[model samples]
Target: MPTRLLLAFALLLASLGVRAAAISYVDEVQPILTQKCVACHTCYDAPCQLNLGSGEGALRGASKQLVYDGTRTEAQATTRLYYDAHGEAAWRRRDFHSVLDAQGGQAALIARMLELGRSNPLPANAKLPEDLDIAITRSNTCPLPGEFAEYASKNPHGGMPFAVTGLTDGEYATLTQWLQQGAPVQEQALTPTAAELSQVEAWERFLNAPGARENLVSRWIYEHLFLAHLYIEGGDQRHFFQMVRSRTPSGQPIDPIATRRPNDDPGTTFYYRLWPIQGVIVHKTHITYPIGSKQLERVRQLFFASDWTVDAVPGYGAQRRANPFETFAAIPAQARYQFMLDNAEYFVRTFIRGPVCRGQIATDVIRDNFWALFQDPAHDLYITNAEYREQATPLLAMPGQFDDIGDLLGLWRNYRDKRNEYEDLRRDTYAAAPLPGWSTIWTGNDNALLSIFRQHDSASVRKGLLGEIPQTIWLLDYPLLERTYYQLVVNFDVFGNVSHQAQTRLYFDLIRNGAEVNFLRLLPAESRQAYLDDWYQDSGKLKMWLDYTHVDHRTPSALYLPGPDAKRSFAGQLLSRYASLDARPDPINRCSNGRCYREGLKAEQRDVEQRLSRLASRPAAGLKVIEQMPEATMVRVEFADGSREVYSLLRNRAHSNVAFMLGEELRYQPGLDTLTLYPEVLSSYPNFLFNLKASEVEDFVGQMQQVSDAKGFEAITQHWGIRRSHPQFWFYFHDLDARIRETQPIEAGVLDMNRYENL
Candidate 1:
């Protein structure tokens, strides 16, 4: 062969190979559609309508067709032809058949083309039809079930609807069966092995690939716990205790709102049940007492009784007679002021060491620092500057020293240390083995801290505190702190949904405990500054703006630069504070924009009023009168049948034939000391209907004897049509006359013993 002839032959061979690799509808696309799209996309009864399973029917629709890639129709796509014209020279190619013909002995080429087009494979448990019609159409020639009724007669249209149609349902089934049996190439061609498919299948299983474990873990921890943020009635004293403890006439459990946290204690176990949600703003003063006072009282009352448990108080023994909430609340404004002053004194004693600290001057300085620290809503850890303290600390001082600048200036390091130590002495109780340089201990990973707290387990605590917080934290901004707490709750279901309502209280406790461990661990600012002074010889350069008084820095002593300078810092600070840019009132001004704040206050008031009104509107189940326990505000009663119980108000308790449970219902008694029960029991189900204000407790019974199992119920839970997770046999018969006028109709009374068992 001549050199030019040889080059031309090589070019021809390359062109043929490229054509063989291309994904054509006939050779590559049809099979994928048949396996995946047809099951849901096609209507079996409507054969003449669109059938996505078939290439011709899939793309030939006239009105709002499915897959239009700008130019070609699905029917047109069935053909393997491409036209190329240059002036007078026109060339037409039948690429699919040509590639197949050229690569007649190359089964690998065909298999590779199929592999490239099959990007996402169907799952192993995919639902598929038993029988399907495969239409093989090319240009004007078509083969579709509806079009091929008359195969023999040809009136130019070939007795077909459109295009050339060929395969019948039975013929297609046989072809599919043969194709699925390895779609064998000629004997001379190489046959791909099953192992090759295993690799392909593994690669194609994208959803369940490498990163899926994390997603699965996340879904498992968080998907079911329902959360709602709404204003509670009558401020924080909403009586959810009565609501949760109510029972139905049939002695069934009711309180659906109760969110229980995981319990790990070896001895006594307790659930952090649903309490009335209370909201609090950290800096705001007045909103504090109204919301928190009643809650503290309730928590104290519950824990004081034999039912609940609380581990400790801020600076007191765990077994102390006084509740921390009460102790904290009992401190008069004067005492609180003195407490802050005493804290300041302690801070001065520790850091200044040799006192240049005049008592009043020290108090004034600490107050200033404390105010500055409190002003920073983000609560960037440590009022003083410290770096890398989140992972490792240089010295142990106190929380507010870095965070409460007012205290820092008023009282030095010495005072801070003493105060912290004193608080630690008050709260520490040994529940685990001692570790080096630590008083009390617990053992758990950082991820398990919230759970440990929920379990109130000391060993678990030692474990959590021993490990590092997976990522380095620079600053402890309120929002970021919240994010960490949220993740903790989600991963461990720690406080269950209890923390959602008590976020402020929980975080305060966490910070307090952290302070007990090492005050510096909780606040890095004090240490960060110390680190900067130690490392940066050119710290003077960074100090130029230290004197500037911007919006953030109102004092000459304070530095207001954004945290972790992009150029100079090595460790990024946790100063990821979300700066508010919108029109917020000048916080210092009592009423910067009176209208907005007024409206906000009004809105809050309206919300409380509305909630209270709705709660008040809830029909009292029944009345009761207490005779023996005249002073008891609420009384409990057991029903005659022993199936139901309720609580009622004391006055109502004495008047009615029944006794009450926590003051909400009348219980029936059949005997001498008989408590007469009401005809029906009521339990409140929150968030049931649209736009409804009141809580609802629709009649519930042992699984309705015979009820309509809504369509798609079993299908969703089924592995296959034949097997379901919950299965039952039941029939309900309705009393038609009684059901006619009722709003919540007694449609039918179900009598399914299996229904209850299945549930």
Candidate 2:
């Protein structure tokens, strides 16, 4: 066993193709799962509560209970992976069944499941059999070890990868071999580099600094950024850490305070610490934020350098914790406003993607696609006038204080009345002193303008106004922005009973109305009511409830220009003002007036873009295919030189108004629906994927345009779509993932396929 002899033997084994069993689970096997399995297995909607994002989650195994049950009468016990339980035994005590066999035998459920998929490979290059249900609402068929024989016999297609193509041969072998070896938990500890350690120390010291002002500031920062995957700027980007409240201070082992909400009482003195995040980063929940010496200096300037004093630190009581205005009022309003304006996209994402993994009720309050603009702090009435903020404080109280269903009616009444009073006061203020032109709009930085896209249950937010002009626009000021953060991110409870969820949704309705009304105030007085009527047509009695008449008609907008389409004119003016910050003109859709070409695109890519641009021009009303298309479809064009590019085809469904609580389908206006084409992936959840060769681009576009029925659509899909059962599904997926990482390394993660459509 000398060193030279050992090296020779290793070379001999490699020559004979005898692979060793020392495969790194963290480096190899976990990556396969992340790319192929984690899509449907990470969040609350994870199938059977089986989370495969981490080693701990894999060992914790699966549960029969559903985490997102909407019919529950009371809050369910939280089963957060890292917090609720620590080991296999703790999970077993809570009724979770193991998927791995301790004996390193073939009896392991995971092993058998993989073997089943290998033995019964899906039909190649075809639609999945109807028997295999892959819908998001499908029933959980979590077969236990004893029930595997019956389950497989009944549904042979149901395997580890589920309805999708099975893992690659190499990936299958690596995973099966690891499982056969008792699935040893051989993940290495993610030790920080010296620089990372130094940065962590500096951050912990700054956060745990003594004094009431510092304590209040740290608390505020933590509550806002508890969900952020923070990394030290210019350090290892993959090595992200979370800001956690630990009972132990810096240099000690973190004893994290596992509270339901970030602001919940820790029941002890806690220090903010940087805890290394250990898992595969999933796009659905990953919100990246950078922290460094520069960020530290910026925060100091925004909060500490300013002349402000914290009279006392706020308590974690429900009333005080639920209302940010009440809690952080002592902080200079301009400082707080600018802090969020600096990273408005990150804060907006906290509310849009932070609260629930899948929430139609919460998301349905706003339109599918909208542009959001913020109000400048200097021009914001609430931020400049103390009396206005004092009056609005009581009206801003959020829901979820208590989780009783009986409180819904009473809470609704209280919120409704207070909202009405606040609206009247706002109208009177604006009437007394109208906004001076576009002065109210925050034009400080790129984050001032935002684009939000709702892909049904899930959504995404990106900085800079994107796509064509949207149907609705939000003009948020300091008070409105603060209220949105508290209402959606702080108070929303995914595990709460029906009442809590409903009230959160109800409160957001008011916030949405306020924003839309604020935007309407910028239009000419005569055009305001007409716009409201069009936006809320066929809303029925809900119109009366929403109270659209409260808009400020007495105030004439200083920026008003007389035109038939005032909205379009106003949007054009704003876009012209921020033209420097406009997103890179998309080669596919934005080049309609040009030759549909860009400097970086190759000749073939330019040709493909020109052909595909036709799909974006199809009239929404006559194009029957629009109705059949999924919310988001990623189209990949493979070139002759083996290079490829991906683009997103998003269907922006039109609605009369996003005001109603249920029956969302009734409000759909197919005639007004439109398609937005982006020359890159724009959503975390893609419902379908279509792969075509550069030569086939024109044909694909032609087929898509001619599709008038389900049968015709199926024909088009068979030719161009990468259906779940296609033999090359994994290949296309890996290519798409690589392209995303290459283009957007800082923002990319494994795209979730839970919503990947059967069509």
Candidate 3:
């Protein structure tokens, strides 16, 4: 055909909406983006909200806006040429595909960069496109002397691989070639790695442990244990990201690498990585997060058990081996009165160390420090700092344990013998210390000091209860340290909400032991010391064994999956089935915001409350009467079946300043000195909705105990805030109604269980 005829045919096709050939987006554009852009242009804090992390992010073309708000950032980024041409949102909306066809013009950022070595049209120190008051359309208007000059002058990426030197000829060619060929992301399985083979193998054994199902070492527990940050690279089938320990075993520092995997398998994809998370356990995986297991076989498998056998748990002994609930479970439900009276600080710190994260932070600081390993065996650790020394004295008995100003203060009495600084036998030099207490231990490598600390097996929990908190309790109690403590009791927060706005009804009373702990915590420093000293005066009592009680309350409430975990158990099934996410259907994805989801739960709780309230109809029988005892406050009750029970109460009267416990309802006769704690009979479910507020129990108790009747109950509960929605209300309602019936007995004609129709 003639040239004129060919042109006419192309125009005819254009009229029919047939598009011209363009570079492939996956093949061409993405390569340029992934290499030159994504690193700095991330979500949330990207310079201009131009998220290039994914192909879609790039195509979206800057989901945020530009500002002339005169911020510091605007001033620093001005010298770079990345903002010319495609930098402007309106210019980029024209699309890179058209710019690719145009090849080299001011309209295309990529086109101009590609011309670097080949042809140099942009002049020396050309003005940036965005800098110009007028909109940019093409190249010569902003020419550079050459591509090399362009890199030195403006390419903040230093042209291609933005460095002081700039990209090599071969490297620049590869980028240009990919853009010309079209950027195609090769689709395949995510690659795996053998780097942490021993770790991964341990995980496999743990998952397939002997009796994981019956013992409940299920998928839900694994998700609750650890967290991971990883990703999969596009176009490359073998490139996959995996996590590794932050440092190596040889005391050699190893920066945690974004590791590559060998191959991908469905069973291996998106897993709870067995990376050696940082902590103080030598030859042992120190944290025990899957709460209630007798042996925690799931996580225990990853740890080397030779040094940490059932008989030897390093320092705290096997029975009290580390677990998230190790400290929480050990609390004698009877201790809110018994053992706590012996050592208030010991009891409170032990209680606070219940959570895994807090314990991990505490252990991280003291485990392998100079003092922890080499401190004089019989010497007393001093506290001249006056801040942390006062707070952490309980756990700092060892060398690595004391508060360090990185100076002579944390040093032992024998600093002269080992380090051999003879300047002044007593004095030593110290530098500014690491900020967060967890860091000062020199974690980057296996220093000789850490090795010494590791060998002794001397790690202990850092519950600030017995710990003199250098600052405050903010360090240990989190998730549990929210404002909800005041909210739940005041009944002020929304039904399913977490904030602490006050309302009319309160629902929760604090844990009894927590109440006693807080009472002492609130005392003046000297008074507290005098009180603790007084308790220690009762030598025989202070020496009693730690309560061996064990239990866990946290449960799965939401799905913990990037995609569905096919092996999900009951908790996973419910959460995934009910609370999916934004893009899914109702009942699965469900509810718009957290408040709405909580409201749904609140509604269900209301229904259950109404049903349980009927049980309170009959006159309260088996009600106990509070009787003050010479040794402790006592409550004695006669059952309908002619059995008598007595319970030791920290406070018998309905006082706001006491925490409530199930031990207060134990079966008893007059002669026993012990309360006969039914360790297995758990009164509350320690799930997230409940357990997150563990630290706030005493505060909750004081508010709740102020009123005894329904009016008082409503006032304490913040107008029955949780109603039937929270499981706690069910327990509280039953106990409170029984108390109400006992205190104010109904007439003979009142409701009874027998009055209901028999099926």
Give lDDT per model, in order: 0.22, 0.81, 0.25
User: Against the hidden reference, what TM-scores do the models get?
Assistant: 0.17, 0.94, 0.24
Could you give candidate 3's per-residue lDDT for residues 449-522 as a string of tens digits?
11101101112222111110111111112111111121121112111111111111111121111122222322
Which one wins on TM-score? 2
Error of 1 at 380 (Å): 21
Instruction: Give the per-residue lDDT digits (tens) of candidate 2, residues 361-402.
Output: 678888888889998888888888888888877776776677
List model 1 lDDT by residue over 206-259, tens digit each. 212233332222122121111211112343222111111111211232222222
Better of 2 and 3 by TM-score: 2
In what order do the candidates fall by TM-score, top score first? 2, 3, 1
Candidate 2 ranges with C-alpha deviation above 4 Å: 1-23, 102-106, 546-549, 586-600
Q: List the lowest-lDDT window of 10 residues for candidate 1.
A: 451-460
**Lowest summed lDDT window (length 10), candidate 2:** 583-592
Could you tell me the TM-score of candidate 1? 0.17
* Model 3 poorest 10 in a row by lDDT: 747-756
Q: What local lDDT does model 2 show for residue 180?
A: 50
